[model samples]
Target: MPTSYVKRILDAQIYDLVVRTPIDEAPQLSLRLGNRVLLKREDLQPIFSFKLRGAYNKMLSLGKAELAKGVIAASAGNHAQGLAMAAQKIGAKATIVMPTTTPQIKVNAVKALGAKVILQGDSYDEASDYAQRLVIEKEMTYIHPFDDPEVIAGQGTIAMEILQQVPERLDAVFIAVGGGGLCAGMAAYIKTVRPEIKVIAVEAEDSACLDAAMKAGRRVRLKNVGIFADGTAVAQIGKETFRILKDTVDEVITVSVDEICASIKDTFDDTRSICEPAGALGLAGLKKYVGRTGAKEQTLLAVECGANINFDRLRYISERTEIGEKREAILAVTIPEEPGSFKAFCASLNKRNITEFNYRMGGASQAHIFVGVQVVSDDDRYNLVADLGDKGYPVVDMTDNEIAKLHIRHMVGGRAKEATDEMIFTFEFPERPGALMKFLTRLGDRWNISMFHYRNHGSADGKVLAGLQIPRKDRKKAHVFLDDLEYSWAEETENPAYQFFLS
Candidate 1:
């Protein structure tokens, strides 16, 4: 009986707890992208997320018997908060199961909403399993984050609001995808009512569930997903959402962490708001589409989805925004170790603003200098590289290299001249206390520590670069050690940056 998506959307129970957000024009972003940018201010919702609309709709639709039995749901953050608050409004007991690795800020926020918070495993799947088990034992209704029809219809209201508010001609609407609720709901409604307008979806390159689904013509689970955009770090799209997406969504695009950070800055400049990485995804995709198609003076809309983020994460976002915007260039160049070589390198820069410079002594002939320079455009970086190359300076572009940005820049000096048969590895781990100590404990005390580099990125995880001195004959043992560590890592023994300076 509820199969009519359009009728279900129109008849859905919502608006008591959810606000009809404004569609405001983003001046700064519009100027930058050469398109009239409009933002669907879903971040201004009561819960600071669009999740509330669907959560409340699903909760309100349940009969009195279901409400009396209570409700339970598993989420990394936003959905849990939304469901908890909705249950409170509906006078029902609520329980939320969250990953142990969820940020303290989000966990605290949900707890403050008067929900029973249960910390489960390290991922959403593990937490979800725990919650599902509780539903049977407690006889409670389970509120799904994105898979249910009532929930999708509730989110569809946002599309209805956008069409009513922004009646002007629109070229596209950009939506961010986690389990594909927002995209699926909006795309379905938009394509149904206004099929001429493009419905585009964006996702973090590291956590692209919707993209994976469209590729295989079915849902495909990802082996690993990045945690930077934790809100959308879903490993796979929902069955119901994917079903809707396949019919309505036009394209799925992936954006890097840096691009997401840059888009966050753009959002702040235009609306004076700071959005989480998942929140900025829509804007990031809109910019990418403009760049790819060279589209101009067209009306484009992006859903400013959520504002729940750790305040400390601003530092990491600010640091990478410049690179994302292509305003800064980080490079590795070989220069003579002589005194004048340093001055010559500076002269060749033509007095461009140097954002950073790190040098470590190399072999007798030359040293490698890791430099960061500010430029107005990408072409400026190319010209700088050409000029340095013409002057006989060997240069490598590290502007887009993850290793250089995350690890090598923080490590200015690390050499193992006397330590023979040394091997280096970079690792990423949860940033809790004693995490690094735990990692070291796993490595064992058998091999001597040759080099170590680590620093706080002020995000969810900590990065570490470590070197161990072991004989070539024991390389197989080292491989066995790495497999046991169970942390995300890569060996840099053959990396040129290590070879030129750290070796």
Candidate 2:
């Protein structure tokens, strides 16, 4: 009864490198959603990710002569570590070409696995190119991060385990898609074994290669991809992966960074374990699906795919979780510059917890204050905003505003002195030694920095608010600097919060 892909999955040689991760029910998340949400604990694997299964299967499939030649791969992080560990198992040598900009934790992990590490370009694309060249030159066996038959077959084994583990009829299964390896494998197996179950794929909104491919009915490349969910960030889906995913995958949903942060929190509360954004992506998509469709009580399984989280990322996850979960509302209120107004605003809060309040007494007639307050639900946020507006208070809901969340919340002070022709931008300073220095070095010495504020959230990325003097004549230079910076950035020069306060 098994298809060729399912038969391949059954024959995969992976148990030597992978543990049979557990599938457990998420009681807390289930209670809240009025559905039984089951979690496949792939994060519990020895490498803290499911990549080991595919990596090992692929490497072991090579002939003794091929294995003697060594293995080479290009990965942002997880796949590199997985391949290195796989090589160690088979007594084969491996060379991993990784992005130089990868977090130190991931880079060190691969080195510890006895793989030769080569830090190459700023992205996976560049690193893969370098690896491809080396594959031909060294005659090494190239282990692709995804898109290989052995890797897909190996990943499909997870579906076999899931079928045996889940007792009830599963309504749906949500999986996070990167280069489409995991999703393609799981969907293929599930579609054959349990055709009744729905297979949904999740992706980071900024790097939705599969979503684009599905929309266009062919593989399409994205010019840019978001690195926030670094493990799942791929510019395009692989050719073979797209061929299978188009036919087998049911639906694909894309989630935002904030939503991913919230999903990480949800996993923590349910399992007391934190997952990286890409790891928590399936849960994020499941939540969105439930909310959007107003789904009733149903049996759902979300793959807890990987837990290779950089410890520093917790602060950013915690900070964004509140907004992502709709438990907190940020408001910019225009209060009169008169006394007793502050007390009045406090009184209007109606016993809710005040998470943040920033007021600097901007000027004579009026003062603007940025505030964050706890709320029970989305309706609570709407009601609070309405109440404030009814009281003749001009308010702007900063909850879903990108400019407000990233920049305004941090820039809660006065304007710089005579800072003319100043262009402001928010950037993520990656966590690594000399990274800040590298950023500064790239910024030419000609432009004067008018204002700078940085808040380290103890994560892989530090939030930085930069105001630079880019006069009309030098505006082109600023654009060039940003283009070459190789960092995630958002321009805030035209944000409402900037006009209300910093400007």
Candidate 3:
């Protein structure tokens, strides 16, 4: 079917019902991509999303009798708020079914809109199933999050707004795909009006329903969905929406979670608004596509669809953003377990500030240490590995290792030990430029250092673990030196490994 019917309906009412979101020229992004890039600021909408446009359009299209019977919807979050707000405005009852795992902030937001919230199942699919059942039982109209023709037509209004706002013709428009509703609707309208402009759909690699569906030539269920981008963590694309997107979208791209986080931070740098990971998918695709094709002088648009990010999650996003950009490297180093061995290892490092260090005595022979370093470019990584190898200490780069990335970053070795003349001390000091030098200088000749470990946890304060080998008779003198030290230190002299290995 021709998009003319949807276009006609949009012209008649959607243009007025939906807010005309801004399409600002992004100079920073343009310089990065070597293209004239524009951003559609749908994130600034009243509901902080483009979802309101579709939900309002769908509700407004229903007849008086249908509206009187009320509406039911299942959403991860944004859609529920959209439908609830629209229904309240139109004097219609609304019931929203959301997954039990949905964030409390989103659940409370829907409740604030006067919708009766029902928490069901673990995922959107399960909530959807419950909503479907409620629809049949209560005889309420089911307002799908992204499937109906009305919702699709409403979302297409974004294209109309983009065309009106950007004077120059666009080479392509990138939209984040969840159930394909936004892409299907926007592509249908834009392709019909501006056939030369290409429509691209972007999805999270971990939750790429449209990409998989296109590959299989039919819609297929995903075995697992990534929760990082909860807004687009869909298991399957909508049937009707997929039909429209299959032919309309020129390309589908899948981006990693880290890529999406980088894009989110990039958008924040440009606009200072925190965009949810799903909302940043379009920008991520723009970066990847522009790099791959090396296409310049072309006009491009990315939809900033939503900005409803959880405040608590911002810390994690910020921490990972630089890492995602390859601006930091984490490594595991195996150094000689002998006197002055650590001092020699420190001398081998090329003066780059040590970001983190952690070490624990594995046995009587050797120690395993974790280290983090900052780097400027990809070539710096090879140089670092070669430099360590040249120093006779081989390093295992954990920058790309999944297990090390997630768990090992926070864990420090604490193996069992037996007590002997060997004593373990924990020291805390202000992590400054020359703090390590002062500590080492203070205890220079008083004791023989048997083992040591230090790791900076992205903090200004420093914590160090040291193992000292001393004669049992000299314990009294060792206590006097430790007590006179300026820094805070604790003695773990009766440790099991101290007796078993050090003795």
Q: Which is the leading candidate under TM-score?
A: 1
Candidate 1 wrong stretches, greater than 4 Å? 1-3, 363-365
Global fold similarity of model 2 (TM-score): 0.95
lDDT of 2 at 449: 87
- lDDT per residue, candidate 1, 1-503, as tens digits? 21367777888768778899998889977887788999999989877899998999999889999988889999989998899889889888889999877877789989999999999877788889999999999888999999998889888899989988878798899999998888888888888888899999999999999999899999999998887888888999999899889888889989999999999999999899899888999999999899889999999999999999888889889989999988999998999878799888988888898999898786688889989999987898899899889999999888887768877887766665598878888888876668778878877888998888887765657888888898999989888878778888888888776665577
What ranges in model 3 sit over 4 Å off? Answer: 5-9, 15-17, 338-353, 363-366, 376-383, 416-503
lDDT of 3: 0.79
The C-alpha local distance difference test score for the whole of candidate 2 amounts to: 0.87
Model 1, poorest ten-residue lDDT window?
A: 1-10
Candidate 2, residue 424: Cα displacement in angstroms equals 2.2
Q: Report how far off residue 112 is in candidate 2 (Å).
A: 1.5
Alpha-carbon deviation at 354 in model 3, angstroms = 4.0
What is the Cα-based lDDT of residue 151 in candidate 1?
87
Which candidate would rank higher by lDDT, 2 or 3?
A: 2
- Model 2, span 199-239: residue lDDT tens: 99999999999999999999999998777888988999998
Each prediction's TM-score versus the true structure = 0.96, 0.95, 0.78
